[model samples]
Target: MATTNKTGAIGPVPFMNDGSAALGVPLAGLTGDDPKLWVRFYQGTWVLATFVPAIASIQQSFRPRGGDVVIASIPKSGTTWLKALAFATMARGVYPPDTAAEHPLLRLNPHQCVTNLERLYSAGQESMIEALPSPRLLSTHMHHSILPSSISKNPDCKIVYICREPKDMVVSLWHFCRRGKPDVSFSDLFEAVCQGTSVSGPFWDHVHGYWNASKANPEAVLFLRYEDMLRDPAGNVRKLARFVGQPFSPAEEEAGVVAQIVRLCSLDNLKNLEVNKPSSASQPFANDWFFRKGEAGDWVNHMTPDMARRLDAIVEEKLSGSGLSFA
Candidate 1:
């Protein structure tokens, strides 16, 4: 028998050892603390592990509607922040001082506020999706290729995609992966990221896929950059509001609704909130630090020059004809 680690439940089922060759795929590579062995899905080019086969297969059947609003991004690419922004925008009518303590926004993480395609396709999710009211708000990390076929074909559905600087994305992903699997070293993480070996990676492809979609179907897809949001949140919020057909009113604008939304979802504000910091309502990894350091250029502090150059080369090569450049 193969010696398994303490977190063996989370480890990959080695393809070599298994007799069911028909069921097993070749190992892509080892990554993260558990040295998670990865395998490519036959249906999608994206790689996941044997442990989460359900999550992979279940995600395929998820389809969003014309009324649905989805905040999409690769992992660690400002997903949390964008989720908060989208939730706040959608739920603007029932915000602070007006909504009670038991308000959905107060009680839930942005993830809870927005449905995930993967969650929707899981065994228990059919009822959940059916129960959700129409004009639903959702979020996803699925690549363009794997996104629900219905959503891509739907001309009326509005999809919002947020992109971030690849270097900063690497740093953020490193921290996020480290929290759950503390044994993963930064050096190893960086190499995996550079090699496009992380979950939902091949980073540039993820961004380019959405970017092209946004361009090809501007009416259906909206693309926003993290740096742009940081620089001019109000401007972007206004733009988003318009895109989603919820433009702020003169009274609301004068009352500083945009600023209020920004303050409510700020990293400092959300981090300090009781709901975000070790609360009963929070998810397994949910905590103050989950939204830690929502800045663009922090990668400069942690990434060495050689690593940065390598990442730049990767980005340059992948994004050569895309016309999109990281700031």
Candidate 2:
């Protein structure tokens, strides 16, 4: 007889495992305190073992509408920020960024406003995605290469990819994961990053997938860096708006809409919202988990000099000659 777990999951589920069957897939060994944090080598990309089924479904069934804007990034690489910024920018005409307290972003977590493609598919709620209005704003952690031809080859579908420095990304990911699995070691994640086996990792390949695409199709794929956004968020907002074919008009710019969007979506503003508060223990993820220190170079506080150097060397070597220097 199967036993019911605390989560109502039947049978003996692995700790931290999402309980998704990985049958027939090549699974990588667990790297953290959670024995179920398995990753699968799928289609040449390393993905969380649980997300494999969703990825397969997305690749086969996702139909991209013209003018759909897909927000792509390696996890923890300013994805939340980009989603908020993009959503605010695109919908400025409907909900003025400066004065809409009733704005969807103000009331809901950014993740709720812009659905994640894989998670939606995983939940079998893809119908929710289809029901969304056209020129929809969607988010994904999937690598560009893995995206189905319906999206990748659709010239009308725009992709905006954001990436952070590998060292900082690993640090952010460590802190983020630790919130849910406090026993997971930072060293294990750092090693996984270096070995190219972390969830949605082999970070280099994930970055390369979009980096090269952006290079080849600058108009269709907008490449962004988290560090650069910190320098001039308004500038990036303008760039994002323009790339999505929702460029700010002269009047909107004159009214300081860009500045309003920036302020509305700023980290300080979002983190304190009631909707994003740390969830109850029963919830799978607290909305607040996505609102950590959105700063660049935070790796310094968490990593030893030797650890930084080792990861830096690996990132540099893997990205060399690609004209996509993270250093």
TM per candidate comes to: 0.83, 0.90
Which digits, one per residue and each the tens of the lDDT, describe model 2 over residues 1-327? Answer: 433322232211111111233333333333433433557788888876667888898999999887788999999999999988988887766567876677778877788777778777766677666656566788888988899888888898899999998988999998888886786688878887888888887899999889999999998899999999999999999988888777788988899989989999999999999888776745446789998889888899999999998988987898999999886
Query: Where does candidate 2 stray beyond 4 Å?
Result: 1-36
**Per-residue alpha-carbon lDDT of model 1 for 1-327, expressed as tens digits?**
333222221111111011011133433323422323344543444544432454455455556655677778887887777777776766665443134464444555566566665444432445456445445677667777666667766776788999999899889977886666666677887886787766676778789999999999998899999999999988988888788777788988888878877877776766666767765533435555467788979998998999999999989999998889884
RMSD of each: 10.6, 9.2
Whole-structure CA lDDT of model 2: 0.80
What lDDT would candidate 1 get against the real structure? 0.67
- In model 1, how large is the Cα lDDT of residue 244? 76
